[model samples]
Target: MVLPAVGDVDRMKRRIQSPDYRDWRKKVEDIYGCLHPVRLTGLWEIADKTSGEVLKSTSGHILAPCGNRRESVCPACSDRYAADAFHLLRAGLSGGSKGIPVEVADKPRLFVTLTAPSFGPVHNRRFTASGKQAPCRCGRYHHERDPLIGQPIDPDGYDYVRHVLWQAHSGKLWNRFTVALRRQLARAAGIPVREFADHARLSYAKVAEFQRRGVIHFHAVIRLDGPHGAVDATPSWGTTELLADAVRAAHAATHVTMKAFTIDGVPVRFTWGDQVDVRPIRAADAHQVEQADGTISDDRIASYVAKYATKGTGKSEAADRPIRSRAQIELLRTTEHHKQIMRTAWDLGAPVVCPDCHPDGPHRVDGCGCARIDHCATCDNGGYIPGPLDELNLRRWTHMLAFRGHFLSKSRAYSTTFKRLREDRQIWRFEQNLAELGVTADSVTVINHWDMTSVGHRSDEERELAAAIAERTRAARKHRYQTERTD
Candidate 1:
């Protein structure tokens, strides 16, 4: 033990005295000392764009990219992403950021939730209209944090096939729903769908969340705008009531049929579950006076959606990363229901014999002398082809339980984009750096060539040190925020 301690002390001293130590420390500090830094080896050259004079040149060392958006992968990066998402969402609701007019806040806004259709009965928490906690039908009152809440009452009876398929096609379903919503708005306005865009526009920012039952649900901030989008005022005909009516009509009418596949000779269809909830988003001042009915506050809605934006599947579901092999699937930490759903995805995504190509016969060689010699005329490629269900690419999304949609999305006019926000931050930082360096150049161009050297911490000690620094930084930020709130 003494020898090891001495060795560590000597190593630390050597590291501290190294020429690259300061540069490494600065890079780490720039990233708030990410716990898992991605190492890179490259060069950066900054020069005057007009004069073609080199301002600075340096070799790139270890750098870290925003590791991931999932908190499970990197809490620091996810927190940053979540903060950006919050601002983006809040700007659309409260306005006053990213060029959106402050008056847009008072526009007709709604907090809408679109849920997956019920594939089968599952354990769930219930509450009465009076806010009384009600016991489930299983004759047992579950705790608030019950892990079994979303599990099927009868696991074997659950419709895992449709559940995974719905998850896989959820993105398409949402597209169809949006089109229907616009059509409904048009109908309510007594205009054609094509002409509706000329009269008014619909803008929304939506985030996908996994339900307790390991299915995808959507939470959105929907706003109606004028024909020119957020920059223009909404038409007088567009009202909160009208938007609400159109939302209901759209939900009731919207349905997406999968690309016509027969499973066990029965045609399978997909549609949103009957349970749909849409509520008006009241302003902050109105929140205090609004009855505690189902209505949600704008701030609360933005925060809620942002909270889900940083999350992967809920803690109760499969792992955040992709499930690559059978071994990984077998070792997954999810419940049996989720496992069955994953298995269904894999089974459906597996390649199968093309029915049309090999009808009434086993697969044969090309010696049959068919008219289409290059490829099979029926399947258009080969006798063994991807199954119809496989066309959805379910296998690639097994970790998401077959859901491949983006976690967060928005209409073009909803608000500023994440990319824009990040770019603005980078520009601000660069300008600040230039000021500190006392550089008085009119404009500077930077050319960088970087290649990944390695990823992750060099050792457990480095990882622990980075994590400690990150924790301290987070704690300091929290304290400052609290102080500001108190003030």
Candidate 2:
């Protein structure tokens, strides 16, 4: 097969003509075509622990995974993340792997969706209960892929400040929700709230997703286990109905009062939207995701939820890196709505370098140069001052609407972690290297020393080639999986 012409075709041809091209191809496959691979030139040795004699030694360059979880940044790394998330979630739900007991399969579990409250009316495509298309308030049925569908009809009235604050504090809101859930569980079980842990444990794996409107929502698999966790038996009072009730109550009661952060001197109280969905999860052997029964299949739930782990803020709506300046926001080639949101975040996040307030350096509120009493065109407006947002390092996450939290998080008892999964993969590759080196010594110490020469491809041609390789690898995996399933 011939390669497509891309990026300085002569340069690409020169790269292909090199003697090391074959080895380079193999390494790309090994790393799954990482977009920005860290080039490490190093020496590693397997030596006898007791005798200090080297059993095997190698010195060369290696391509390491970038380890970015966002698909917009690196598809290969994102696929790896999704796969790890699947294993981690499935281990908790199915309870046969990752040291989880099989008994957890019988535990009461729920698939919960908590949404962001509406800041304003946005154009959206909706469907009725009978499956007919409903006309939007804009007096027309929008095409499914319409870019305007998620944007507000009246942008002036939209609560952008509150929305950004909610996104920034969503992590803390989740933390509060967990606490409320435990309280609700105790109330339902008729036990003391403080001792709820003694009776039952709440374990969950959650993923944050961005809605088309640019707000965040949460998809979580919440499981009710005994005090001892996955291995222990739940109390007799624990049931699917009770867990669902507790979830609903917790969702209602879980609102965070942003006392430290204010809007117009009124603290913003953030709560989940009205659309709360709770459904039970079935066993791993279920035939379909949505069975004849109301419950969903555990087999498909992991991959389904894990897919969001690789999603960006919103496709084409946000950048892959943190916004460095306001000029960068203006230069982004996306919709005006998204850019405006980013601009708002940036304005409230980063400090302005004014000659009056920050004569020495940039300051947010040190000398009160940007307050309502004085007109500062940069950040402060009428009755809107982001007091603690600057202290929160909001500028560092302006690209994500000031949301500074992990996309995927879980309780400690909720199965394996990403670190453990990556370590296991490294160990497996290490053993394979040992086998290749003809080293049979069981007792040996492995030492690795490497320094990064640089990050990313040296040229545009190399980057394009790497991207194509990653895309092809992803396509092949999908095709093979489908083929196996069909067979």
Candidate 3:
């Protein structure tokens, strides 16, 4: 994928000169300039809902956005997702939009961050209190971009198994933390855990981030409201101080355990690292991000959490898509330490085999009858497949490092949802199109039937052109947004 050089306009000359170029450009613009546009062949019609009289009918080709939220994969759709995330998060924070009450802004709100416990010491670049660069475990003051940073100081001694297992159960750990948080809040109020929900509701929107050490850290906006949720006021006792205390207490109490992995017969446990940070969110002007009194502004917190949703795992240049075979690990562009992590996740997820048939390990052999048979006097069917943390589909999630959680998630009471936001956009689009057709929404219903025709460009020339178009469109959109904000 070497891009064209100098004035290599020749690469895209054909597309730019072709008669279909205008149509192609228009289609790309309609999808907000998607990098990997899906080609669709579809039938679209607007007809009377009651009489079923078709007022408009057409059959043609169209381009749709890929809708990938990862910035590494599709910036166009990623920005779209981030914008939606910002609104959803901000609605819960500042309110006034998305059916949330404006007074919810005064609710007891805290910004919480929870991190992974250390598996082992790793090389890092740290700073002293006065801002001097501190020495790493390797006894060196590493540069910020040093390639060796975050790699295990003792590669062999580093607990790769513990790290991988923790990663796989991180989502479960977060779920447990929320439950514990509710319990802690209730205990602080001297109320039973079961009756806690009747007194107050806990709502949060959290996003997962991958630190340089290749583990997930969650940043969340926690708000306390009455039993009915955002619209209802929090009880008189639900103060920001109390909410922060409960969050810290919950972080301290939450731990998840897995089956024994060693001959010692002791269970492996996972818990959050000691770096729990809880900051109060203050109401301020949209321009204020961090207030003078050490509180974070609502606008900044929403923007901060939304960006993480587009992130990839850690500093590794690993595959964005799933890996089909173990051999692909060697081809990854990340550091050897990340490679080891991926390798551990892959191997630990392998099926257990009979000691007699494949004593060397469960590495499947060609034409082997053992893997196919159960209780065949050979392989014992692998005993439900010993996946990492018993997550049977760990192999399927190798690209994600076995963390099977949504990057951005929220409780039911947390304002609006991503689905609802997208549906609203669709409705607005429908209205715009209907107005153009001079049709009333109550009189006609639009129907769309589409099948995939193809995906992506057929040549490097088309890809380069599409990339250019995407950049231009994105810049224009940014300019428009900025202009509107100024106005």
Candidate 4:
């Protein structure tokens, strides 16, 4: 590999030795360890918004956003995002952050998993009731890390069409399920569905995870709260058992009827798959004590959900990068099954000619012969209508296997929001910086005008140095935590 220039190295040393190096380093610390930092150049001023009196001003300087949420894209930013997710989930369960009342820990909380129905049989690791390894349907015992575990046994028989359609409408299905869950809860409590809102409320934070089979499943932390949300007490009828029952009933009953559209002259309807799993979340303090029936721990659930929040389909046989063209789709590094699904999406997204119009035939309008309109008799029903395939919007989400929904979502009452947490962090950092600078202010406003300058590392040597620094920082943090535990 080509080495870094000697002049560049000397300049870097001089910059590091500069009098303002410490301040500059602190300013860029947030993005210093990022694999790819979004560099920006701008002038900034801290002034009074009301009086327009400038308190502080800075000339043009380089800044980094460090806002990426994907670990594969930027490890530093993703680590921060995951930490925020952990706090958000843990606060909802333990109730020590974001102004959530501590009594929320006493509420009926559940760590539920809602899965996508199986489109077809795939290679899976099967276990007997006694926790013994069992042979898969294909007559072989698969390993825990088997690459073929999620691949279809019969690729040709796999339902790629419904799979993509289900992925596309997964968000809608979740919405319907939530509505049904509230109704189910009301019915179980012997109250009218309309009156359910007056008695209790449901709050949840969910993260979508892609199984090895390339299908998306939701892992959610669902909590039953009082009608006024975290502020009020839960009703007497709001028990963990009742919540579990409602979850099962809602998952079984919920379905979304896709808009009527023809796919090769046949109508298609979408619904959730048959597989659904729901489990109660124990108290955080008691999470370590496992139940006889293999119950999930609250801490484990929080960590699991948080971990997946920064992940993508790359863990499985799917592409993390967007597939914008036929060439990209064909060149995707995935299993044959995943490749086929991507191809189906691309094929569906391609524009098709109107079935009513024939290029070689004459128009029905008198002397109009308008070839543009498929139905010349009336412009109302003319031209090409989006078929079921086109309605899927496959091209926009081809990289996600046609899933267009966010990987992480939450109800309004589900603890604190990502935005709130980020804002709090920003305020804390600003305060710390002000203290370091020996500045005191009752109120201040920051005005910023930034333009994109550059992104990523300047050279492999710089990337290596940044990565080393990041690794060391992580190690130091880990060591400190261990030391605290030991102490």
Candidate 5:
């Protein structure tokens, strides 16, 4: 697309007709003769930095991204993200990428699921070990494909207020849980809590997800490592069995006590629900084993976690405001179990001052009503609820309060640090860049100049040229594909 440019062209025209134009015109002609036509080419040059000597250079066809989004949206970049994630997880688990040893997998490995306690009963797919389906509490024999599986089993008894509060505080609760878990592990191993660090370290990657009920649960890949991380050897006593036991003990012992809420002159305290499942990660066996009822290996775990990475609190009426509009909120509110949560969130957002909780500082991040993220101590408006918001669909996650974290996030020492992996990627990119420039050896030195400019679509003439080139390229590809197919 050619931009309409009158000023520059007009200035040049005026200069052409000036009184001293004859001499000036001769100089302009000389310069214009030297100007190169914009014949497109992929080109590069490299030179010795100090001596200004040419060392190496190379270039070839460059394919710019189309910026599409249809899964089709830049398949190159999307595949890159998926591949990187695969390598990242594979590196932490089996230690393949980089120099991480396979021995790391032999350490105390656990694929665990930690759930939110019940605020109220939400509808769930219920079946016995023999696959006998049970009736839903809603007094209906729901079908196998019922969409209400994650909704409140009993809407009136559900506690949406508590659920949202838990979501808000989920991060803090996880931190506390980790601390308690370390203590439990040390106690199980007969080591002092302080000495536990000396024996082994806890490495984990966890991803949080919102259930159909609109509450978050955590799926974590937890491992035990030596003090130095995956590279070091864990103590002799550190076994998967011991780790499993410790996890159970930790879960059983863990509790968070909030100030009592007075309901009709009675005080109430809330804690984690009784449902906790701690399992041992058995030795790796590729063989497929069938249970009495057929359920294949959990293939969707990665996709499940990946799905939540793009979700927002607004999806469950978990955010103060919907990301879209009030109409969207209305849709979510009218959904089976999200209405009560939406109403409660709106009601909570109305009052400037918290009824029970006080401001440790200004109630929001800057002028935005959202809480300040980095400097958290500045706000005491933790969004604590006086009573659990009774809404079954919103009940299970009463602990979270209303925020969600990414699944499979980790601290620096947990497995390999993301920083280190990123460094590896950077090194790989640099190597590719050098290779592209035809640099022969690692010892070779090179320098390159890059002239950055924004180029808009050219005039009709240029567009026609580009279209012709594209047509030729497509025809060439079709010919090549036909040849391959025949061969």
Candidate 6:
């Protein structure tokens, strides 16, 4: 075959050596990384048409394996995921191609907190005015360094089982509460519950948190969207106080549908307790709350939610690396304070010993004070002994039952989703690529599939190959331009 002109060869060589060429090639590969593995290989079949099917194929190494978390497991992929999430959330808060408008900031907004009901009285650190110490509920003037800060003072009396059930149903409880809220809002608006969606819409972003006792609490940024959505304006009747009132009414009136089951001929029903709190979302309020007890900041709230989204219960050693098995318990590197809790969780998960054949007597903690025992000096002996370690184990056990999900959970209309926004972004990028290549058509179709198996630096030989490709593209462009000039 006849080679291109000498000038074309020289131009190609220079383009291959250019830094811009290298950068563009890297970005093209990065886009491929954003695609799923199966789709990446299929992209090779897209016909170039003008270029006789430029079957650009690689070793299929840049694709992500699965769900990305910024945790130590996959930092590179996690960073990309976080960036995408940031843009997705911000777009809803501020108008983007997703049709969100800037006026969203002025809408009625509230930061609400709803909590699980009291399981039992715990050792709470009470502080008086001027920061003086008040006696704890345990009747001991516990110091700041006390180990029982959150431990239940009455573990046996505590409704640990109920607490666990609350967690499993918390998501459902929120749904019921929202329904009640809409009814209340409609009553205030002088409209029917069925017509409420047409007048004003409620939009919110919420995150679930596990308190020290393993009780799940919710923190949310609740916003009032206009009749239709972000594009429309809020109704004349809507106000922050009205929203707050509706929230309060919803909280007081809402109840979860409990499952009724008969255990050993005893009929039982489960339900949520009466602890609930809802507050307005204001930076000033958080500052005021912080003055008394450092309130959580926005960044703190986001980070806290993000951190727990990847974690499961502390019971499963594999679920959360922090948990330790019996064999690995000795390898704990935490302070003496945390070790006590960790050890308790491990010991509780072990199998019970055979009553007749055991040398160690029992596989349990071998405690002198049993929770089931009736009368002991520490407890009033009415089977009321409250062991702190046992309480910790109960907390862990309850968490395993309740919070068996990722942290951030919300309804369909809470906000624009990450996947939808990401797909839109990919479409925009593809369009931009078509525009740069001067492929203008009334309706262009994308045919290539992208696979992103890797995300870091390429080997030297691969870089050289990419560089050579860039040079050829550059020379081809120059040759076209020169010919057009002669014409």
**Per-residue lDDT of 196-244 in model 6, one digit per residue for the tens?**
9989888776666656555567766677777777777889898878998
- lDDT of each residue in 131-218, candidate 2, tens digit only: 9999999888999999898899899998888888888888999999999999999998889999998998999999988888988899
Give per-residue CA lDDT, model 1, range 1-487, as digits (tens). Answer: 3554443365555655879767766777677757667888988877877898877777857577555776666667767888899989988887878878877777888888899998888888889999998988776788978988898888878888889888888898889888999999998888888999899989999899888898999988899999888888999989988998888888888776764786687777788888888888776554431347766666666778898887642242777777777568888777877888888888888778766656545565653433335667666765677766766888898888898888889999888999999899988977876786567546877887889878887766566666666777778877986787521
Model 4 scores a TM of 0.85
Highest TM-score against the true fold, candidate = 3
Give the Cα-based TM-score of candidate 5 against the true structure: 0.61
The deviation in Å at residue 116 for candidate 5 is: 0.8
Candidate 3 lDDT (Cα, 0 to 1)? 0.82
Considering summed lDDT, which 10 consecutive residues are worst modelled in model 2? 378-387
lDDT of 2 at 432: 90
Q: Note the residue pairs that clash in candidate 2.
A: none
Clash-forming residue pairs, model 1: 117-273
Q: Return whichever of 1 and 4 wins on lDDT.
A: 1
Segments of candidate 2 deviating more than 4 angstroms: 1-9, 48-54, 313-316, 350-386, 435-442
> Candidate 5: where are CA atoms >4 Å away?
1-82, 260-270, 288-328, 331-336, 349-401, 417-423, 440-487
Instruction: State how far residue 291 of model 3 sits from its true place (Å).
Output: 2.8
lDDT of candidate model 2 versus the reference: 0.83
Please give, for residues 169-227, the per-residue lDDT of candidate 5 as tens digits. Answer: 56666777778889988888889999988988998777666677776677666788998
Candidate 3: Cα lDDT at 167: 88
lDDT tens digits, residues 1-487, model 4? 9986664356556656879767655545656477677767787877765687876777665657467776656667777787888889888887877889888888898877788888889999999899999999999999989878989998888888888888888999999999999999999999999998899999999888888888888888899999988888999988999999999999889887654755676766666677777777776665452467655566666777888887752253667677878888677767877888888877777665445553444335544335555544422445444544666688878888888888888999878989999899888977885676556555667777888888876666556656766676667767986787521
lDDT of 2 at 203: 93
| Residue 229 of model 6, lDDT score | 72
Give the whole-model CA lDDT for all candidates, comma-separated. Answer: 0.79, 0.83, 0.82, 0.77, 0.54, 0.54
